[model samples]
Structures are given as structure tokens and as C-alpha cells.
Target: MLGIGIVLSIFGLGFFCWLLFTLAVYALPFLAGLTAGLAALQSGAGVIGGLVVGFFAGGATLALGQMAFATTRKPVIRIIIGLLYAVPATVAGYQVSFALAGIGMSSGGWQTAFAVIGAVLSGCTAFSRMTLLVPPPDGQGTGGAYSLADERLHDQRH
Candidate 1:
């Protein structure tokens, strides 16, 4: 039992750290794009403004995804909401970039590429943070399990 506990604990912690790392990685570029977009907005870059807004909006929505995860115990439902919010954000980001570059929305692959990247970054980062913060079902997996142990132990007794 002790070994199992330790193993589970270690895996949980590792998973949490990985999540944090992923958040940071995804956040950096998204933030950079957001900042650039805002700057563009200031300079009358309407298209850029759109890009910035789309990126930040997606990021904000990603945070919402986190909230959903924290409040809901159902993984499938959480994922659906997260994806629904995030996927549109990504698509919007791509469209904004094309508009910013003065390219038509029908510009084909380039716009799509931007959208895909934005969505991937936002979704991965947000999901990482959300999953870490939320306790898993079955009471077996969650980030910060070590810190939650005292409470979990108490709950176990009840």
C-alpha cells in the first residue's frame, strides 16, 4: 500500500509539473502575439487589432475553460466546453491575421495555419492548468495531491 501510494503520488506530482511547464510554453507565444496585436491596434492596425483581440479573447476563454474544469467533475463535459470555446478562438485568430496582412479571408492555407497554431497553444496551455487545478474523479488523480493529502485523509476517514 505504501509503495502504491508513493508511486501514485510521484506520478501525480510529475503530471502537475508537466502541466505547469506546458502552460508556460503555450502562454509565452500567445502572450507575445497578444501584445503585438495590441500594439497594432494602437497604431491603427485594425486587422492586427482583430488578431490581438482574438488571441487574448481565446486566452481569456481558456481561463474560463479552467473554471469549468474546476467546477465540473465530468472530464468529458469539461473537454467539450473547453474545446468548443477554444476552437473558435483559434479559428478567429487565423482570420484576424489574414485581415491584418491585408489578405482576404479566402487566402487559403496561411490563415488556417495561424488559426491552428493559436488554438493548439491556447487549448494545450489552458487544459494543462485546468486539469492540474481540478481533482480527478475516483479521488485518485489531481495536481497538488501532496498538499491535499491532509484533507483527503480526513475525507477518507469519513
Candidate 2:
């Protein structure tokens, strides 16, 4: 029974991590909404009102970020936005790493190293997910398309 419980717990943790990875793009917005809602509730706003305000605020922020990312053609601006989007993931990564390290590992260089590794992985994952590469319209070659011919040409160019 103990073995079975441990196996189940591991599976549950894996699933939770997978879900977190898949929904990383929404983490920031959800956190913003949650914070706003809690503050409003504490400030004497009714539960419903607080929830409504939080939902709209969060959705608007997420939409604005998405629009900026979609409309911008400047690489520098896009990179900046992408980095902002990854902030939540990086924070979560650091926390998770710290927790894992605290469980059985030492509390010095090893913990810091784990945290940095986690932050990098999570930040990259978030950035990639948030800044999706949309294919150019009408099959026009934009050097972003992945195909055998494109690969061959790219290899030849190098």
C-alpha cells in the first residue's frame, strides 16, 4: 500500500507539472486576477463584485499583452514582451526548485544551482509558448517554415 501510494503521488505530481507547463501562458494573468480579487474583497467589495472586477482586469491585461505581441514587428520590442511573459514561469520555477531542494538536498550552492536551472527551463518554456510563431499567409516563404527543402537549403547556406 505504501508503494502504491508513492507511485500514485508521483503520477499526480507529473500530471500537475504537465498541466502547469501547458498553461504557463495564463499563469501571470491568473495571478494578477487572484491578487486583485483578494484585495477587492478585503476592501469591502462584495464577493461577486470583486470576482467580476478581477476577471475583467485579468482578461484585459492578457489581451493587451497578446495584441502587443501580435502587432509588433520589431524584434527588440517583441523580445522585451516575451521576457515579460516569462516572468511568472521563472518565479514559479525558482519556488519549485527551492521546495525540491529543501526536501532532501543541502541548502547552499546546490539549491541555488537547481533554482537557476529551473528558472531557465521554465522561462524558455513560457517564452516559446507565449510567443508562438504564426506561419506567413499564402504559403509565402518567410524562413520560418519547416520543410525538407527548407532544411536542405538552410544546411547548404551554412
Candidate 3:
């Protein structure tokens, strides 16, 4: 019975990780594209312009989507929160790249910076999600130590 339980728990954790990975894969692109589109439109670019916007927007979207779903039940709220979290990171990445590569930093430099920032921001999102999913103290049972409760409940007496 104990062996079966352990096996089942491992399977469940594997499934959850797969689900998380799938969600992240889909969400980030959408967010980045959306933001980019809005930016292009606001700047008076044409349809082609919006496409460019959407590309970036999709990445931003994905990052936020991951973070948003990490802890909350509300998809809308999660997306909003995710967006709030991703935008600044994105901006900072662009700025830092420009600064590091010099005032006239090449586009490649900006791209590199964006990638680094995006990765860091995504990590933050993952951390937040883990935080949310972790059970509360009451649910943690025995604080990871061998508890008197466990001994009383399941210890086999000789």
C-alpha cells in the first residue's frame, strides 16, 4: 500500500509539471503579441506594424500567463497580474541592453538583453506559481519531520 501510494504521488507530480509546461508554452507568445500590436496601433503603424507589435506582445503575454495562473483561480485576474509583472521587466531589458551596448546599441544587443530579461522574468513567474501551489501550514502535516501524530497513527508496534 505504501509503495502504491508513493508511485501514484510521483505520477501525479509528473502530470502537473507537464501541464504547467504546456500552459507556459502557449501563454507567453500570446501576451507578447498582444502588447506589441497595441503598441504599433497606438504609434500609428499599419497592419504590418501591428503584426510586429503582436510578435513582442505574444512573448509578454506568455510570461504573464504563466505567473497569473500560478496562484490564482481567476484567469482574468491572473492575466492582468501577469501583464503587470511582465511589462516592466520587458522595458528594463530593452533599456539595459541599450545602455550596456552604448547609447547607439545595435538591434542585436537589444535582442540579447530582451532574452535575458524575459528568462529572468519567467523564472519569477514560476516561483510565484510554486508559492501559490504550496499547501498552507495546516496542510503541510508534521512540518516535514517525523511527528508524534505519525507515530500514533501509523507506526507499527512490534
Candidate 4:
């Protein structure tokens, strides 16, 4: 029974860490949504209204960020947008990593180091994922007639 408990705890921790990593990019949108939800509630909106407002606010925040990142041609502008999303994720990562490290290790220095590593990885992951909002640079994956024609023309020349 004790061994089973230990195994279950390990699995739970792994699942939690996976969830945290997957959701890190949404931290900024989540904060926005939470704030909007609380504001709506404070203004006497019912629970359902608060939830609706929060959901919309979060969705809009994410969509707008992705749109701005995807549509902009300037590298500097894209960096700025990526940073906006990554900053929150990095901070959250630091906190989460520290807590996770505390579950096993007793050394504060090691915990801090792991936390820093986690922050960097999480921020980088969020930054890279920004590209997912846009189509591939080659345009072939978009399934457009232009892409097919371009391919055939290139094939004939070669």
C-alpha cells in the first residue's frame, strides 16, 4: 500500500508538471480573464455573466496577441509580442519549478537553479510557439492553387 501510494504521488506530480508546461503560454491571457471576471462580479454581474465575460476576455486576448504576432513583418515587433506572452509564462514557471523542486530536494541552491532553468525553458517554449499562429513560410501547407502551380513550374524548370 505504501509503495502504491508513492507511485501514485509520482504520477500525480508528473501529470501536474506536464499540465503546467502545456498551459504556461496562456498565463497572460488567464490573468486577463481572471481580472475581467472579478471585475464583472464586483459590478454585480451574476456568476454566469462573470464566467461569460471572463471566457470572452481570455479568448480575445489570446486571439489578438496571435494575430498581431502573425501579421507583423518586423522582427522587432514580433519579439515584443512574444515577450509579452513569455514574460508571464517565465514568472509562472519559476514559481512552479520552485514548488516542484521543494517536493524532493532540501537544498535551496539546487531549487533556485532548477527554477531558473525552468523559467528559461518555459519562456523559450512560449516564444517559439508564437510561430504556430502563422502559416508555414513555404506556403505549401496552405493547400492553395498558387502553391501547386508554383510547385509545378519549379518542377518543370528543374
Best by TM-score: 4
Candidate order by decreasing TM-score: 4, 2, 1, 3
Candidate 2: give its CA RMSD in angstroms.
5.3
Candidate 3 has what TM-score?
0.28
The digit string of per-residue lDDT tens for model 3 on 83-138 reads 55455544543444344344334687566765566445544554364345434444
User: Which residue window of length 10 is worst by lDDT in model 2?
Assistant: 134-143
Model 2 residue 5 lDDT score: 88
Top lDDT prediction, candidate number: 4
Q: Tell me the tens digit of each residue's lDDT in model 4 across 2-27.
A: 99999999999889778877898899
RMSD of each: 15.2, 5.3, 18.5, 4.0
lDDT of 2 by residue, 1-158 (tens): 99998898778767756765676677688888888988898899989989987898789878888888878778789888888878887888777766765655776788888778877777788888867753344444554465657888999999
The true-versus-predicted C-alpha distance at residue 89 of model 3, in Å, is: 2.3
- Pairs with backbone N, CA or C atoms under 3 Å apart (clashes), candidate 1: none
Which lDDT values do the candidates have, in the order given?
0.58, 0.77, 0.56, 0.89
Report backbone clashes per prediction.
0, 0, 17, 0
lDDT of 2 at 96: 75
Query: Which structure is stronger by TM-score: 3 or 4?
Result: 4
Please identify which of the two predictions, 1 or 3, would achieve the higher lDDT against the true structure: 1
